[model samples]
Target: MSEERDTAPSGAAAPPGAAPEIALPERVDVFDTTLRDGSQFEGISLSVDDKLRIAEQLDYLGVAWIEGGFPQANPKDAEFFRRAAAGELKLDTSRLVAFGSTRKPGGVTDSDATLTTLLDAGTETLCIVGKGSAWQVRKTLNTTLDEGRAMTSDSVRYLKAAGRRVFFDVEHCFDGYKEDPDFTLSVIEAAALAGADCVVLCDTKGGSLPHEVQAITAEIAHRFDGLQLGIHTQDDTGCAVANAVAAVLSGATQVQGTINGYGERTGNADLITVIPNLTLKLGVGTLPEGRLERLGPVSRHVAELVNLPLDPAAPYVGTSAFAHKGGLHTSALRRAGTAAYEHVDPALVGNHSRVLVSDLGGRTGMSMKAEELGVDLDAGEAATLNDTLKGLEADGWVFEAADASLELLMASAAGWEQPYFRTEAYRVSGYHRADPNQPGQGAHLSTEATVKVWVGDERIAAVGEGNGPVNALDAALRTALGRHYPHLERIHLTDFKVRVLDGGAATGAVTRVLIDSTDGDETWTTIGVSPNVIEASWMALVDSLVFGLKRFEG
Candidate 1:
């Protein structure tokens, strides 16, 4: 797709602590911060070059602002700001921006050195923090209530007077509003009085309930006629996105969130979910039309840039966001457009409705799903197969979590064709460290796996070992089959979650392992379940290979 089409606003100014309640279809600003706040994830690390590349992609997707990074965090951050200073990062519809805290205690308000540095970075906008939480003031600043207000007003006024466009993040404003409504309102009043452009209420600890968020945001909109109010939520309680959306529904317009919910703790609100939730669901405005369809891809791109695995269950952007399982759900989707299994048209988010068939599929549902997938199925056969699927479920095969594999089983059972390879025999063995390291290294555990496969007249063998038995088996299976298919170059094990369906005595526990893989452009999930983890891994492994073959062969 072409990257250039339109230009985002050169500037948008709002009175502090008010609502920017502009009305328009297909236009709401997505202020992305996957770099600044997203990089705060426990294991996530993005480089200067990585941020630039992601910024370019976000621009192509038509975000309003991409928070480039925290310029003062470390040498790496400072280096990115310095490089970004060249203005080389250009977006047709997105502006590169940076974030930083307001002046620290004892720091001069006018011409503070860090403010100078943030402005000099040449980022189009600056998001700065101002103290709004009473707890933060009393515990961190050791200041009385009046001193905290001075610190906030002085910071905003100084930043605005310095001629740098400023967006004020009222750190922990929601919590403060709950504990000390009067004091929180005072902070907003002060910021608005100081000419700050925007006042963003932040859930620094990410624990606000949705009803509370809606109430507070509504109160702010009603009280602040001359200021612009926004919401920034973290996801400690898994309600950050919900809270942010409720805030908008209650009257707040501007919303601040990371593209993929990256931040300290559980993470910030996920814009990936919020954009469509606001536009298509809540009837609110959003930035750049149609890029909303690219939410899933854009999310995956950011995760990939940060060397992170894509979550299959991530709402709106995960692999399973629009996936339909169970006979009833698939039958409904087949009968109606997203009525049976979904709340929104997945196509609006650049994803197609996925119908997965397995145990629990009814004849009607299987017929509908199969017809939608262009599979040739007779009613009688479909009914019989549905029964068969139910039987398999009774035996403990989880088809919902592994649709790719389930589809292959359906196709094969329906006499589609022969598989390219079949398991003739396989062996996975356990191992332990024979000798404890006495020199420089410590003792370690070991495991081994060997597999043999048959393809008509040819037979191949492969072997591997790992710290875990399942990993070793997966390695061996892939190795045995990889030589014949160069496309298997980068299939990986993204996640392995085990669910004990019949939890009880040792003999009664049935285990299921879910495997997610990617072949570059798209992602797929496979499932395997059995009494043994090694056997479960093999089932999923077989499904992964065969399902990928079907996709490419088509």
Candidate 2:
């Protein structure tokens, strides 16, 4: 364990008669389980390549340890270890720890397949889980309490004898301590006696609160005096991050969690949130001195590898973490900087403060947002743009999630026009027919679109066919602009979302369409609204192409 540090900043004087600041550990070890526990998340499925890439990202973020999966249980995990040992994966700062369970009940560790696989992993450290609760030993494992204790001790002893460091994860530690504190202590003592390097208390059920975790961790830290304690928690109660922090404040030295809180049920603790809290708020260091800035980019990159969208409102790393809206908030932000509305400087975590423009915003918000989009907005232009924004939002046009469209509107307000091709007319037609391959099964539908445009005094008409009207229109527009804008080949639509504003109107309800497009390097969103879905989609699609062209040609 590192030496304690004062919570107060240096050279800062406390008020007279104020209570003394609480001391906290100077550094805490961050153990990341994104590859093992995070893969168990409902929507995440990581291949070997994905795991390798995620491990690289974690290393870049400067986590202390990365838990690879259970090599003995699955061939995929076994192959990952094999490849890692074969020099396919190189870690810069983090140690790759192989994860598994203790030897089976009534089995000897010398011949246990699980222990042998751990030895084969060739890693310096191993983390093995064992039953901690007496009830779980008797009910889940169908074994006596003594055998459960032996399972943990024997596995630890075997791994230690092989010249490898070992971390003992006591499964259900919190519930076990509440039910039978003596039994849980005995299990932990046995692992310590067997030469385990760190004993991690697992909140397997994820129902423990911060107070409970702190008190129990304090008791364990006192009883075992000199032994390193760690914490692993789930997010079933949405308190995993809080509980982990509480344990750290109490006495735990290592915090176990996954990036973005990815796990089986609710999740494990989100290290993205936990690391910053410890570093900035609690005056504890988790990563290397300069590595804290990688948190946001690493969180986003890992989410991308897992094929899951990072939550916009997630603490520290999310897009909305530092976004300011409303008239008063934006006004205060302009007057006092981010200190008026933000807790910490967003740049500390690789994020920047943003001013969100909406109908509820004042002129300050509009001007700030326009500046962020690189559009010069004078006072008159800003006020006009603000009024125009409110009017459009009244008609169901949203620009908060459509920054590309907002940029175009701001540029138009500044007396700039899009230099792309001008649209003359467009038409779409749909047809349906019975399929010859499967009679009476279903009808086959097809859509076709024709676009006419003037590109540098040349009138061009292009036709395109697709499975849907939007797709056909996109194809037709691309065909019409391909020769003039060869860079269009790099632009692609990634996502499309639609929402109805008035359910009462049913078929005649106003529809809002949002299109997400990327040009291999930058991504932007554009939006359109209309009572007709086709017309709304067309409006958004046109904006998407124009925005991409503007970004490229500018």
Which candidate tops lDDT?
Answer: 2
Q: Which pairs clash (backbone N, Cα, C closer than 3 Å) in model 2?
A: none
Question: Candidate 1: which stretches are off by over 4 Å?
Answer: 1-28, 133-139, 178-182, 210-215, 236-238, 307-311, 372-374, 419-554
| Model 2 Cα shift for residue 164 (angstroms) | 1.0
What digit string (tens of lDDT, one per residue) describes model 1 on residues 1-554? 11111332323456699776644333445678777887888898777799888887788777777787777777787887777666757568877777887776666766676676677677757888877878778889887778788777887777777676678889889999998888888988888898778788888888899999988988887799757677889999999999988877766667878877878889989888888888876577676756778887788888888887778888877778877666666655554556445666666787666666666556766775666555677877788778887888887776767667667766766779745777877787775454544654655578888888886678988898877877887787778777776566766666777777777747657778788877777677888888876677778877876777777755
CA lDDT of each candidate? 0.75, 0.92
Q: What local lDDT score does residue 193 receive in model 2, on the 0 to 100 scale?
A: 97
Model 1: weakest 10-residue lDDT segment is 1-10
What is the overall TM-score of model 1 with all chains considered together? 0.79
lDDT of 2 by residue, 425-478 (tens): 999999999989999899979999999988878999999899898999999999
Q: What is the C-alpha RMSD of each candidate to the true structure, in Å?
A: 7.1, 4.2
Least lDDT summed over 10 consecutive residues: which range in candidate 2? 1-10
